[model samples]
Target: MSFIARTSLALSAPNRIVETAGRSLAYRRFGTGPDLVLCVRLRGTMDSWDPLFLDVLARHFTVTVFDYSGLGLSTGTASYGKREMARDVDDLVSALGLTRVIIGGWSLGGFAAQTFAALHPHKVSHVLAIGTMPPGPMLKPPEPLFLETATKLSNTVADEYILFFEPDSAASRALGDASMARIAARTEPRDHPTPPEVFLRSLQASIEPSGPFPDPDDAYARFYRNTDIPVLALSGDHDIMFPVENWYALNDLWPTLFVVTLPDSGHGPQHQYPEMSAEIIASFVRHTAAR
Candidate 1:
């Protein structure tokens, strides 16, 4: 075989191990038992989470994860926003024949999960929200450095880089430069979440732009109200993306909200403190179930 053939074989080999979502998603499931669906954030794919951490969660219960619409293995464009993406989650559950789910979303995904639970309370068994906030500018703006980094990276990375390549390493694939509109069309579909070209289009919009931008789904409400299901909201102590103070706002919205604060972590506590994250989740699930 030619050299190109050899290279293609090697790359596909690693990915071959991953399962497909028929025509609707490209997701992987590990372990078995009750269902726990992990929702990815805006501009996020499954790669945003660490494999070792997934393994830990898998040990306790079945875990299902997929690239959100327009982002990862699911086929589509990448620039979609909150309401559309939330629809994607509902479609994903229906497509996968998931009748009941413990929906967990981090960052944007976390907000999405709450939104989903609020929108479809019967389908959602419980909710786990992490490091997330509503749309629109903050009452108090983010710290200068954090805002600077976010704006800089948004413009530079081609696409949002959840797990950016190291300075010494080669840059991420070319798809990071996909356009905003193209990315927006990637809803959870009947198959792979996004076509690779669409992924590339989303990359284009990641770069910092000079004008107006879309906000996350929840711009008006601090917390989703009047839900009866169990809820767990966690925020990292040092997270600049969504400061821990947001938890207080969340608590105000839902008086009985279960809140946990990680002492020394950043925006992605699940990735940064997997053991703690997992244990906390397990406890929440058990406590929720017992109630």
Candidate 2:
């Protein structure tokens, strides 16, 4: 399907639910090629993704987007740790009968994607970590202002702009606005907003530092270093949450790691530059699969 075609479908795609791990997990599937399961960011539902971005990805792959258990339309208790979240993804994938798939995660989802690859390397064909930091001590803490703003129960458009877009650039702000509009386009059957308590729990699980790395060389060598799967890590150069330098440092350690930095973007590079992000992801998936 073409990007436009997929975008249209994604805007109207029905939300599907599957019973996995004794809970009903809400998910959406689009596109028509190899399976690509995308994990949602912290406290975000499947509807949190931008339609334009989803459409671009759906055009080239079978894109699967879903909410974590107990969040959005999904039913069950939520898990805070990345490993537990990864297990939930494994259950969802197995419930769908997908044997081998590429997994992509954004933000906290990126953490889950990395854990999933590390824990279930045989089942995952490749890993795409976007706007994420590597696991362990080497990962930098997010700015205090970003964290404080993000934790607010209700965020205005201006607040969202601070979190997702580069504040100094009007073009980036415009993209952020457009992305929010696309995110809001899915009107009917919308997901239930994540409760404040659940949101806090999940957020804490993701940001709490994983410290006590005795070996300097292995500070960031927990999951990604152990997995042989082809890995692609992308982030905006101006990402305030997880800086682009983190990925560069990661690549320095693991030379095989593929890293891309989108110019002038903040945390949400995919939202800021959907077309470029989609192209990079699609091309990488194709090239890696061929290998």
Q: Give a tens-digit lDDT track for model 1, residues 1-291.
A: 333233321112222122224334566566566788888754566555544455567767778777665455555545545555567678778777789899888876775676677677788777888777543335434455544454332344421333221122132222222212223322322233344455445545542242112345343344345556777877766566666675666566664478888765556666555567887888888777413
Clashing pairs in 2: none
Identify the runs in model 1 with alpha carbons over 4 angstroms from their true place.
1-23, 134-140, 150-223, 289-291
Prediction 2 TM-score vs. true: 0.91
> What is the number of backbone collisions in each predicted candidate, taken in the order shown?
40, 0
Superposition TM-score, candidate 1 onto the true structure: 0.68
Q: CA lDDT of each candidate?
A: 0.57, 0.80
Candidate 2 lDDT over 1-291, as tens digits, reads 334434466777788999987899988888989999999787788878877888888889899988888888988888756777898899999999999999999988987887787778788898898988776554565677777888898889988888888888999999998888777767666778888888998667654444322235352366556556788988988888777777776666664589998887888999999888988999998887413
Estimate the TM-score of every prediction.
Answer: 0.68, 0.91
**Highest TM-score against the true fold, candidate:** 2
Q: After superposition, how far is residue 90 of candidate 2 from its true place, in Å?
A: 0.2
